[model samples]
Structure formats: C-alpha cells, structure tokens
Target chain A: MRVNGAEVEAAVDPRTSLLDLLRETLGLSGTKKGCDQGACGACTVLADGERILSCLALAVQYAGREITTVEGLAGPDGPHPLQRAFIDHDGFQCGYCTPGHLCSAVGMAAEAARGVPSYVTADLTADRVVLDRDEIRERMSGNLCRCGAHNGIVAAIAATYAAGPGERA
Target chain B: MNPFGYARAADAADAVRLGSAPRAAYLGGGTNLVDLMRRNVVAPATLVDVTGLSSAIEERPDGGLLIGAAARNTAVAEHRAVRARYPLLARAILAGGSAQIRNMATVAGNILQRTRCPYFYDVAGSRCNRRHPGQGCDAIDGHNRDHAILGGSPACVATHPSDMCVALAAADAVVHLRGARGARVLPLTELHRLPGDHPEIETELEAGELITAVELPPLPPGAASGYRKVRDRAGYAFALVSVAAVLRVERGVITAVRLALGGVAPKPWRARTAEQALLGAPADPATFRAAARTELAAAVPLRHNAFKIELAERTVTAVLADLAGEAR
Candidate 1:
C-alpha cells in the first residue's frame, strides 16, 4: 500500500483502521484521531485525492491505494495555503481538529467548485452549488470543531474559494 | 479484538461456501463489522473477505440496475445509470455515515448492518432478544424513543437503520441471494421480516446465504423521487423519521405511487394504503396529506415515540409535495 506516495508493508490487524495504520504502524502521527468513531473531523485524510474519514477506513481495503495525510499537505514548502490560511485566520485555538477541518474544507471546496450538489443545495440537480454561510455549515456538518473555531475555519475556506483546486486565494 | 483467521473469497459462490460454517462471517469493507468486533458485539472465528467480487454495474435490458452486492455505496450512487434512473437511492446513500464509510460500506453490508439500539451495543451482560434469543427485550419499556412503531413484536422493537433499504422498498427493488442451495430473488420489501414470534430472525435471509445483487426496476415516465429524513443532527445521524417517495403524476392525478417509511418500523414500512389512496387522486397538498394520514393510521407508538407517528406523517406529506412538484 502507498502512504504519502511511499510503499510500506507492516503487519496490521484485520480490524485496524487506515488512521491507526498510518499513525501507529507507520509512525506518522500527523493524522490526529480526536473521535475514533468518525464523529469529529480530526481523522480526515485524502484517498486518491478524495476526502474521507480515515477513522472509518480499514487499512486492508487500501491495498496499493494512495493515502495523503496531513504530513503530505506541505509541498517541501512551509505549509499548504489552507494550512497558511488557518494560521492567518487564527483557525485553531487548541488545534486538535485543525488537520481534519483543513482536509475536509479542501474537499468541500473542490466538490462545490465541481458543482456537486449537497443537502442544502437549493436544487438537488443543480450544476453549481453556491457556498454561503449556510452551504458551508451544511456541507461541513460532518466535521465538527469543538474549539469554537468554526467562524475562522469558514473564513479560511471562503478565502480559498476563488483560488480553485488546491490553490489559496 | 480477538484474533481470527482471514480468507478473501474469489466470488459469491466462494463467499457462501466459506460462510456456510456457523463460525465464519463474510467481510466486505469491514466498516460496521470491524466496529462491532472491536466492541465485542460479534466475534466470528473466521473472517471471509469479499472485496474481490466483480465490480460491474450492469444495466438490465428492461431498464433496471443490477448492482453487484459488493458494490460500494459511493460507486453505486455515482454510477451514471443509477444516477439517471434511481435518484432516490443515490440520494439516500449519499446521506449516510460519512464519505469514508460510504466508500467501504457495500450495498449488502448496508442492508445487513446491525441494529443501532443503545441496549444492543451494550454487550456487557445486557438483555437483548436480537443479541441473545429468548433472553428478553429491555427496550420495550425503557428508552423506546428510537424503537419501531410498526411490525414490532413484544420480543423486540429495534429499527432497521439502512437509508438505502427504505428507497429500495419504495422503488420495488429485488434482492438476489446466492447460497449453498442455489440462487433466489426476494422482493426488497420482503427481504426484512417483522419481529414476530422470533425477534432473533430479523431478515428472511436463510443460513449461509449471501446477497449477490440488488435489482432496481425501471422508473415510470414522469416518475419523481425524493428522500426526506429528520434526525437529531443534520448530517451523519440515523433517520428519526425518514420517508422515501416515488410518485408518477399524470394530468394532476397520481398515476402511481410508492411510499416507504424508515425509522418508524422494524422493517421498511411500505405505505400500501397511502399509495392506493393516491393512485387516482390529485397530487396536491390535500390528497397527499390525506394519504400520509392514512399511512400513519395503523401506527402503534410507544410511550416515548408518540411524536414519531406525526413526524413520519409530515415527512411523508412533505416528500410527496416535493416529488409532485418534480413530476410537473
């Protein structure tokens, strides 16, 4: 299996989640596990560039699949734009849920840009979903930040809206 | 988790053969099964992985979707044929656990996911008829808010928590099952059995049988579909009162209608009476309201779940209204 573009093989329990495999087995703790039950956004990661709850993913299912953790969010630079924006907007107080929030925000913004309709999207079949406060709140409803930094997180996401696909405006 | 031997099945036949043993359990994505194993709800001696099954999403010549049982919820929802034909199913799958869970959770697994009753999860010497047959039902008189209002026996009232099953029932889908004895197709609505004499026997699935596929019939022309669910929270929560509606209206009259209610029944509650009422009536608010009222007429709510009947009625009416607008 590929973790951050590197192939690694280690003995994993059949019940081990991808989050545990990355953090415990592979020694990559960048992916935080706030709620192991998939309630919080702390265990969010990208599988083949699509955002998913890592805490709910089984490690055995990701054979030869690409997994991008928070450690891979940087590109030899100091940080990704979402990460930088989180800093600029003071997106974290305790910073426990920041990684999952950042990953989910990136995926949500990409989905919105690609015209994926969500629950709050007025038209279910609409091509484009406008990202207002309500849309942000509804689309990111699966990811919760207990630190009360949602306002800042929303600001950071709004800032990256126009930049499009991995770019921060 | 207890250590268990693992074997990946080559196909459906192999899966059934391996699962024939009482100690072996078929494993799909391991989303729910793994969680249950960690919680010690289920402890199988052997795990048979079925991820190697074919991923083909075949469209029947009669205009139906032949979804492989192993098909991930995400793939089944995003398939072009499914999206264009059965939008209700796609919508229901999208409104489940999470993106990751959907990616791993198979259609068969979703249908077979265990009950979410709080007492069922409390395996620490708790009494649950579904868990331990004949032990007794502790939920009948205690914390019955999420309990079923329909098709519930005195033994158990645990609600089946699959959003897709509700839509499947409304869409008149068929479940293809393969076992050591051979293959058979059961109507999706009849797949789940009422908790009658035996609450332990939840579904009609025979021993060693594996769900191979779910077959969805073609939608009628001008058929509009909708899924509406009210839960404790907005996203990622089980349905409190969910309604799946597929209605066809012609000249302001409901030509045909299929209604199924979730979270209000032990199985998917097919609103046959309500559908019959709307068959030749106007697809307006008044008719939909009357039909919704007729469906909840037989609801026997518990002390704490009296609100579910009214909530389900409103949900049914609201979905009917939304679907009627789509038909026009």
Candidate 2:
C-alpha cells in the first residue's frame, strides 16, 4: 500500500485492521485506538480522499489504495492550516481524538467543497452548500472529543475553511 | 479476530465459486462483518473479498438508477442523479451511521446487515436463537428495549437496523442476484424475511448467491417524498424509530402513497394498510393519523419497547404531514 506519499509493505495477519498496521507495525502512533470499533472516529483516515474508519478496515483490503493519515497533513514548510487552526483555537484538551478530528476535518472540507449536503442542510434544491455553524457541527459529528472541545474544533474547522483552498497547507 | 484466509474475487462468477466453500463469507466494507467477528458471533474460515468486483452507479435508459452492489453508501448518497431524483434515498442513507462509516459501507452490505439486538451481540452469556438455533432467545425476556415490536416471532425479536433499506423498501426497488445457479431479480420488500419459525434465516437469497446490483424505478411525476428518524441522539446513533414516505396528491386528494418503517420489525416494515387508508382520501392530518394507527395496530411490543408503537405512529404522521405541506 502507498501511505503518505511512500510505498510501504508489511507482512501482517489477514485479520489485522489497517489501524493496527499503521500503529503497531509502522509505528505511526498519531492515530489513536479508542474503541477499536467503528463507533468512534479516533481511527479515521483518508482512503483515496474519502474519510473512513481504519479500525474496521482490513489491511489486505487496501493493497493498491493510497491512504493519507494524520501524519501526512504537514508540508515541508510548516504544519497544515487545519493543524495551525486547531492550535490557535484550542481544539483539543486530552489530545487523543485530535488526529481523527484533523483528518476528518480535511475530508469534510473537501466534501463541502464538492457541494455534498449534510443532514442539517435545509435547502436540497440549492446548488451551493453553505458551511454555517450548524453545518460544521453536523458535518464533523463523526469525531467525538471526550474533553468537550467541540466548540473549539468547530471554530478551527470554520477558520480553516475560510482560509480558502490555495492557503490550505 | 479469528484467523481467516482472504481471497479477492476477480469477478461475480469467481466470487460465487469461492463463496460456496463450507465456511466462507462475502466481505464488503467489513463494517458489520468485522464487528461481529470481533465479538465472536461469527467465525468464517475464508473471506471472499468482493469489494473490487463492481462499484458503478449508472443511470438507466428508463430514467432510473442501477446501483452496483459494491457502491459505497457515501458515493450513492452524494450522487447528483440520486439526490435530484431520489432525494428520499439520499436522506435515508445520510441518516444512518456516520460519515466515516458511510464512506466505507456498501449498499448491498447495508441491506444484508444483521440486527443490533443486545442479546445477539452478547456472544458470551446471552442465548440468541439467530446466532445459535434452538438455544432460546434471551432478548425475548431479557433487556429488549431495542427489540422488535412487529413481525417478531416467539423465538426471536430482533429488529433489522438499516435506514437505507427502509427507503429502498418504500421506493419499490429491485435487487439483482447472481450465483452458480443463475441470476434472478427480487423486489426489495421480499429481500429480507421476517422471523418466523426459522429465525436463523434472515434473507431470501440462497447460499452463495451474491447481490450484484439494486435497480430503482423512476419516481412518478409530482411525487414528494421524505424520511424521518427519531434516534437516541441527533447524529451517529441507531434509530429508535424511522419512517420513509412518498406521497402524490392532486387537488387535495391523495392519489398514491408508499410508506415503510424501520426499527420496528425483523425487516423493513411496509405500511400497506396505511397506504391503503391514505389512498383516495383527503391529504389531511386526520387521514394520516388514522392510517398510522391502522398500520401500527398489529404491533406486539415487549415490556420495554411498547413506546415504539406510539413513536412509529407519530413519525409516520409527521412525515406524511411534511409531504402534504410540500404538495400544497
């Protein structure tokens, strides 16, 4: 599998999940394992630019796919805009779910840019999806922060979204 | 998880051949299967990965949709054609699970997903007839707050936990299946079976039969549809009760209506009696309430789930009311 712009292969058990392969084998501990189930989004990652739970994904099933984890968000110059925004907005407290929140926010921004509507999107007939506060909360509902940092996370995501596509990284 | 050999099928025929093994399962997104495997509820010796077989969602010549079985829930929900033509389907798909899960879950697997009864998931001590036939069901008497109140037998009371399937049921979609025997088409309503004497058997598909695609017919003109789900929370939670309704009214009279319910039965419950009650009647709240009551009268709730009866009625009434407003 090609992960984070690098080709890496590991001989793992067929039952091993992608999250385990990233953490235990590749030693990428940024992705935390909270529930080990798909209920929690701590293991969220980008598979072909779509956000998915790595905990429920089998490693062998992602053979030829390109995966982007939390560690892949930064550029050579500095941290990604989402990372900087999170820090600026105090988007985390315990920090266990920060990686998931950051990665999910990236995918959520792309989805919104593509005009995907959320549950709270009032007008289905509208061509453009406006990212208001309720839209941000509904779009980022997958990731859960135990420390009650939802307000900060929402603020960070809104700031990053306002930064535009050219200033993302 | 238990050790299992994995094989990625090259095609539908290859998947059928490989899935015919003694203890083999067709793997889709691995959301439900992996969770069940971790809980020791099911242990397959071989897993035939069919995710690569097909993922196309094309518009049919008849102005309908032909969705490949492997199409992910997120892709199906976000498709422009689906959102424009079948808004209820998109809404129902979005109402389920979460963004990450929808990104991974496939349409076929979502239809075939198992129930979420506490006893069925409690593989350690609870005795579930669906998991272990003739072992007796613990949910029938034990904690059954989420159990079924309709179409439930004495042996099992588990409810099918799928929001997408409920919409498909309301839309009258067709399920296409392929196997070593041959290919066949079945209506979405007949895809899943109720817990009769044989609670173990869930779907109508034979062993090794693979769901290839789901074909949805074109919606009638001037039809307005909607889906309403009342869950434990606002998002990322299973529905305690859900309603999917389609209504076409002309001159303040109901011309046609289709209603399906979730979280109330072993399969997606089609409110046929409710549809009949509303057909030709005035599109009013009184008719909707009467139809909802008529459909929910057969509910036989357990000690804890009796509230679902009222909830289902209210949800159905509310969805119909919204559709009526749209018609006006």
Candidate 3:
C-alpha cells in the first residue's frame, strides 16, 4: 500500500488496527489516536479518498489501497489549504484534535463537492447540497473537539470550501 | 486484543466453510467486532474476512432491491435508488454512527451487531446473563436508563442497537443467508429472537451461516414511508426511542399501515396491533393515538426506563401523522 504518496510495505499482525500500524511501524505519528475505539475521530484517515476511522480498520484489510494520513495533506508549496485555513481561523485550542479535524474537513469538503447529503439534508432530490453551518457541523460531528473550538473549525471549512479548489495552492 | 488467525474467504461458499471452523467469526467493517475484542467481551480464535464476497446494490427483477451484505453504511445511505424508493431505510442508516464509522460499517455487520448495553460491555461485570447464561442481569437492578422496556425477560433487559434493522422490519425486508447446508431466506422480523429464557442466543442464524443479501419488496404505489429517531443528543448517540412508519391512505381512510419501534424492545417491535387498529380507519391524530395505545399496552418497563412507554406512544403517533399527511 501507498502511505503519504510513498509505497510502503510491512509484515503486520492481522489483529493490528491501521492506526497502530501507521503510528507504530510506519512512524507516521501525525495521525493521533485519542480513543483506540471508533467513537473519537482522532484516528480519522482517508482510504480511496473517503473518510474512515483508522482504529476500527485492520491493517491487512487495506493491502492494495491508497492510505492518506494527516501528513499527506501538504503539497510542495506549504500546508494544505484546509490546514492553512485552520491556522487563519484559529480552529484549534489544545491542538490534540487538529490532525483528525484537518483530514475530516478535507474529506467533508470533497463529499460536499460531490453533492453527497448528510443526515440533516432536507431535500434528497436536490442536485447540489448546500454546505451551510448546519451541514458543516453535522458532517463534522464525528470529529470531537473537547476544547470546544467547533465554531472556528466550521468557519475555516466554510471559508476554504468557498474559495474553490484551484485557489487552494 | 488476543492474538487470532486471519483468513480471507474467496466467495460466499468459502466464507461459510471458513466460518464453520471452531471459534471462528466473520469480519465485516470491524466497527463493533474490533471494539468488543478490545474490551475482551468476545475472543474468537480465528477471523474470516468476508468483505470481498459481494458488495453490489442491484435492482431485482420484481422492482425491488437486492442489497449486498458487504455494502457500507455510507454507500447504502447515499445510494440514489435507496433514497428514492426506500427513504426510511436511508434515513435510518444515516441516523446511526458518525460519518467515519458509517463509512467503515457494513450492512451485514450492522444486522448482526451486538447490543450496546453498558453492562454487557463491562468486562468486570459478572451479572450479564447475555454473556453468561443462568448467572444474572445487573441492568435489571443497576443503571438501566438505556435498557429495553418491551419484550424483555427477567434474565435480560438489553436492546438491539441497529437503526437499520428497525426500518427493515417495517419495510418487511427479507434476509438472504448462505450456510454450509444451503441457501435460505427469512423475513426480517423473524431474524431476531426474544430473550425468553436464553439471552445468549440472540439471532436464528446457524453455526456457519453467512448473510449474503437483503431483499426488499416493492412498496405500494401511493404509500409513504419515513423514520423518526429520538436520542439523548443531536449526534452519534443511540436512540431512546425510534419509530418507522409506512402508510397508504385513500380519501382520508387508511388502506394499509406498517409500524415498528426501536429502543423499546429486545428486537424491533412490530406494531401489528397498531397496524390492525389503523387499517380501514380514519387517518387522524385521534386514530393514531389510539393505535399507539393499543400497541404499547404490552410494555413492561423496568425501574429507570418507564418513561419510554409514553415516548414510544408519542413517537408512533407523530410518525403516522407525518406519513398520513404526506399521503394526503
């Protein structure tokens, strides 16, 4: 499997979660593990461009997939647009949940762009799903911010999304 | 987590063969199984990964849907066909876990997911009858605010935790299974069993059975369906009480209705009495309330969850009223 644009391989225990393999064996400690259980979004990562909890996923099950962690969000220029947006909007208090929040917001932005509906989506027949404050909050509910920095997080995501994809770099 | 041998199955048949091994369990999304393993609630020596078997969501020849067992919760909830035809199912799926958990959870795993009873998950608690038969149920006298109110035996008071199964029961879906013996189909309502005297045996699946697909029948032409879930919080929490309702009305008269309640029973509580009371009757709040009363008459709530009786009644009435209003 590829990790952060690099092809990596290792013999891991079948019972080992993807979060464990990434943090322990691959030395990609950018992805924090708040709760080894799936309740917390601290272990959020992207597999095949979709957001999934790495703690519940077995490393062996994701053999041939492209695994992207928080470290993979940066480009040759600097931090990703969402990361920069977080800094500009002050989206973190304790900064423990920033990695998961950044990755989750990236996936949430992609989902919104694809017109995917959240639980609060009223009109299922609509071709475009509007990403208002309620939509962003509901979509990001999985990622918990114990420090209660949700307002700035939502603002950063909304701002980054409004800036279009090409303006990110 | 205890060390376990892992084997990936090639197909459904191979999955059944592998699953028949002693102390072997099927691995779906690992959302619940891995959590349980970490808590030492269950320790299977072997794991059979069945995610590669089938994951398609195809339309059946009879205008129904055949949802593969391996389909992810997020994929099923966002499926265009599911949203159009089975909105109740889509809403129920979305009402469950957060976005990340939904993306990883599978339909089959959701169907077979265990209860969220805190006592059942407590490794140190020795009073869970579901974990150890003939022992005792601590929730019966302990902190049981989230326990069941209906269809609970003295031995156990836990509730099934899947929002999707409640919708499936109201939709009259069929669960397709493949076992070492042969293929068979069971109605969604019959898939789960009441605690009765044995809370240990939750489902009717045999030793080596693997859920293949769930088939949903076509809805009536003018029928309207929806699901309503009331929980402790706005996000990522189990339901205190949930209702799934499907109704068809003509000229203000109820032609057909199907009702199911969750978080109130060990299995999805099919409100047959309520459905019977509403058929051929006027579609009004009075009638809906009466039906709810008739169905909730059988409730035997414990110490802490007695309020669920009133909550279930109001939920049922509201869901029916919404469906009836839409049908009109």
Compared with the true structure, what per-residue lDDT tens digits does model 2 show for residues A1-169? 9899999988989999999999999989998898987877999999988898999999999988999999999999889988999999999999999999988988888887777777777765466777778888877888999999999999998888854522363
- Encode model 3's per-residue lDDT on A1-169: one tens digit a residue: 9998899989998889999999999999999999888877999999988899999899999998999999999998888988888999999999989999988888877777766677788866466777788888888899999999999999998888855522342
Alpha-carbon runs more than 4 Å astray in model 1: A109-116, A127-132, A162-169
Clashing pairs in 1: none
Lowest-scoring 10 consecutive residues by lDDT in candidate 1 chain A? A160-169
Q: What tens digits encode model 1's per-residue C-alpha lDDT throughout B39-119?
A: 788899888888788667898999787888889887787666666678888788877776656766888899888889888
- True-structure RMSD, every candidate: 2.2, 1.3, 1.4
Q: Clashes in model 3: which pairs?
A: none
Question: Taking the tens digit of each residue's C-alpha lDDT, what string does model 3 give over B70-93?
Answer: 999988888888888888888888
Give residue B40's lDDT in candidate 1 (0 to 100): 85
CA shift of A17, model 1, Å: 2.9
Model 2: CAPRI class: medium
Candidate achieving higher lDDT, 1 or 2: 2
lDDT of 2: 0.90
- Runs of candidate 3 with Cα error greater than 4 angstroms are A162-169
In candidate 1, what are the lDDT values of residues A1-169, reduced to their tens digit? 8777788887877778889998888899888988686667688888887777877777877777888888887777678888888898888899888888877877777666666555555555655567877777776777778879889988877776644533441
- Count of backbone clashes for each model? 0, 0, 0
DockQ winner, 1 or 3: 3
